[model samples]
Target: MKKKVQILSILFLGISQVAFSQIKEEKLILDRKREPEVKKIEKKKTSVTAEKNYPPKEKKTQDSLNLKYNITDVPAASDFKTSTIQGEDISPKFNADYQNNYFQLGMGNFGKILADGNISTTLENQIEVGADLHFLSTNGLKKEYNWDSSQSSANIGAYLNAFGEKGKFNINADFGLNDYNYYGIYALTPAADIDLQQKTNRFKVNGYYDFYSNNILNDVRLKSSILTDKFDAKEAQAELLVNLSKHGVEIPMDEVTMNADLGINLETINSEFSLLNDNTSNYFNATLSPKLTFFKGKSYLMVGSGFSFLNGKNNSNLLTEEAKNNKTYWFPKAEVQIAAADEFKFYGGVDGGLKLNSYANLLEENPYLVSDQELRPTETKYKFYFGIRGDVDQSIKYDVSAGFAKMNDILFFKANSLFNNDFSLNRSPYNFANTFSAAYDNGTVSEVKGSIQYFPLANLVLDGELSFAKYNLDNNENIYNKPLVVASLGGKYSLLGKKLNLGAKAIFSTDKTTNSFSFTEAGTTPNVYLETEDKNDKIGGFADLNLSAEYKVHKNFSIFALGNNLLNTNYQTFKGYKVLGAQFLGGVKISF
Candidate 1:
């Protein structure tokens, strides 16, 4: 087995060299040119102005010669990435500036053995490890409509990735494993409170181990995500992609050629949380997407469909974990998407997919914060929306698309302790979620791309949603959460030749409720939970503004600054939860 593995590895390495041989040759040519440039610079001499005072007695002008330093040209990083880490959530993330592209090679999941690119392979050997430390707080006053989540610690483990060659063959291995304990409580004040805690560990290993013989790519490579939780959330995905295109990946200007790939991905998620951890649920999702191109132009279309089978039985133990508490979803789905024109031009596609619960909650944390958690439910939805996409026209421009959706039970946090709740057999109706979104991107740099979204109605929202789906549960059937406005506004702008990045996001809505001026028979003071009918006030949404900038001051050094909650708007996206007023952070990085 060892011998075979070694042989196979060598084979793969060899093939990769052949595939990207063009790059090697280009490097050689570049080296030649680089040498000439250096020689030219060396031959150049620096001019100095005549200065008086070389000798106090002489007081005669003399030419002063200054030393000239040589500037060596370094190649740009191989790809468009900049940071590496313990897990997706752990930071020192890449500089917010999108233009700061330097590749750090490592391993885990994504393109290489490790999704995050860094070159330290020794530390990523076995049990992956990660760390996240964040501190946040606010003034003591717990005001209604205040949005806040206190200090927190989160991280993960397991990361691996390796690519390049295996003897005349191209092999890529990308995989990662992550585990984190997360807890945060945000209040919408007077009426709604969101206290959430989760412990999850996930693993995904994917890669296309290819061996190129006579330019034929072949091999058995697998991609998958494996998850294990404190409760009973288990998920696994496996995909196989076989490239059937003849060498060259493709020849430019030769539009009539098409390279085909046959791929099948199978996924499974299981849970047990009945009376005695007895609610057992299982689902299998399979998909096949293929790419087809026509004419020698820059256009391509990828089409595929996904099918799944799901079954679950809820018992008392199911309630122990909020996600396991609800057994809802369908197995199977239709998938469609098209990427045409070019890698940077027009593209459109859609797929009914599954998004993990943990992943979605991270986005829900703070309207302005970005999270990397992805362990929620097997997001099952019949999805279809298409539009043109590409950086062409200098912006991501796409046509409008609309589609119907059939959603099963979705999971969101409510004020309940999964550790002590009886969820094995009880759940609000299949959580209802309907969504529509549209936006416009300005074709100008340092300009903004804005979007507005809205949710018409909801079946169960305690007080209703505030920005970004901060739901208020009225009763227990209120167990489900809804998108605050189902609508919102957001945009991003690039500044300073793409060195500075700025983004603004906000969502708002209001509704009157029984919550009215119920005074202590005297109506002198207002109650925390007091409500007034027809008295409309913004229910949910946050107007979040975040700004970040990165400037390359030197070849190997860059400066960065991040400002969050820029306006420090006193409004709250979460009820009773008061957000930290304003935050400022500045840091510098040294990487070549």
Candidate 2:
């Protein structure tokens, strides 16, 4: 039994040793495979985790600037122009800024109607058909020695406008035609003087307002334009206005602000005979001014001062042509107002237009320039003014003003021996009879203008106005003198659900002083040359009556009818200039 047990034990021991060796082998293999896989996993990690492992996120910030652009569309036709009495012909007209179609047949105040009434045809870029006609038979003046004349004239005009954008750029243009005429010059001229008449045909155009800025951006603005007046001259102008607000902030209310402006005006006259052989002037006007004003809450004040420079030439055609005058002028100005107290306030301002007319000739060194040294032109004026205003109600207001001024070296023409048979019938140098002097007698003038408004009812408005002016030569003779007075009263009524408006007006003016002297003066006579006076001018008075109505047919369409000198009363607003008689015009307007 001992022998058998010892053999079995030896066998069991051997088996146990083998089992232990196998277990150790399996563990070694497992460790070898797992270690390499774990190492690979640990080595291949994300950059995000690496960064997170290093530090917490740190906040970052920065300041930056930005730029932007803007554009717009507008034309030169949007401005106010001259007044009129009546028309002898019929034709639609445009704004004076784009074209001037004076009526030889006689057209009245086309500009005033465009501004106050509903007439889109007055804009250059419109399509319209209209008629303007007038006839006036003035009763011979009550005086024994009288000025009597009769006139019959008529006119017709039409226009068309095509619309388009300025492309990626902001630009626009307008084209149109106007015709007019005048008569009764037989009386305007006597056997003692030359008789003159005029017929006008005007073609017009204005294009491109290349660049501008948005309202809030007071930074940079560049503008360019070209204008031509057939009866006058051609002009090219460039203007730049820069607002300083871009460099800083904290704009205060009604406080002073600073800015800069640059303007360049170049003109080419039609002929040398039209002026003193020197009508075209090149102007470079620049200013750096501090403005103090605020219309907010009904109060405002503006004051500033800067230097001015003007250079004029005798002839503009020659490039090498030098200017005869290089004038430098400097002054300070102030404007003030008070309207915060609702109904009662005072507003007034004065600017000193101090300039030396013949400072130094710019073309003095250039031989190509045609200049007359004897004209001996010069000028200086002191302008002073004051005014008070009060608002009676939402639609009612009253204003009063006073002004006085004296001018030296005023411009006028002295009769040269060249004109003996100078008659209105002659066109050029022959019957034109004239030697022109740029310097005239010194003079003094005083003027007053004021108006009142009352809206007694919501649908009715009444207005009244008064004006007075007097002028006298400051020379040794003191024989040349002038005085003028004008008064007007009118009312307008709303009708047809306020879609239509009707108005009637009456006015009186001194004909002898107003119309009689409006002509160019030559050789101490009336209506011959510029800076001169016409012949045999006397004082007189005249009256006028006017009526008008406007109706709106749709949002973008309307019609208007107006009549002036409605009473057919004999009158004159300018001394030598013939007054238009009774006239009527009616037209339709379409707008976008």
Best by lDDT: 2
lDDT of 1 at 204: 49
Deviation from native of the Cα of residue 97 in model 2, angstroms:
24
RMSD, candidate 2, Å: 33.7
**Per-model C-alpha lDDT, please?**
0.31, 0.38
lDDT of 1 by residue, 1-592 (tens): 3353354345434533443433222221222211222111110011111113212221111100101111112111111111111111211232322322232222211121211222222243221222211221122223422222222222222233332233112223322223221212221111123322233454444444434231344345555665554444444545554543332244455444334444444545543331223434444444454433332333444444444333323333425553323333333332223444322333334555554333312333432211212233445365444333232221122233333333333444332212222212122111000010111111111111122121111100001112222222223222222332333333333334434433333223332111112112224543322222222223333344443445657656666554444445443332223444444555555553
Best by TM-score: 2
Give the poorly placed runs of model 1, Cα more than 4 Å off: 1-149, 154-161, 166-259, 272-280, 286-304, 309-314, 317-382, 389-400, 408-538, 550-559, 570-578, 588-592
What number of backbone clashes does candidate 2 have, counting pairs of residues 3 or more apart or in separate chains? 47
Cα lDDT of candidate 1 equals 0.31
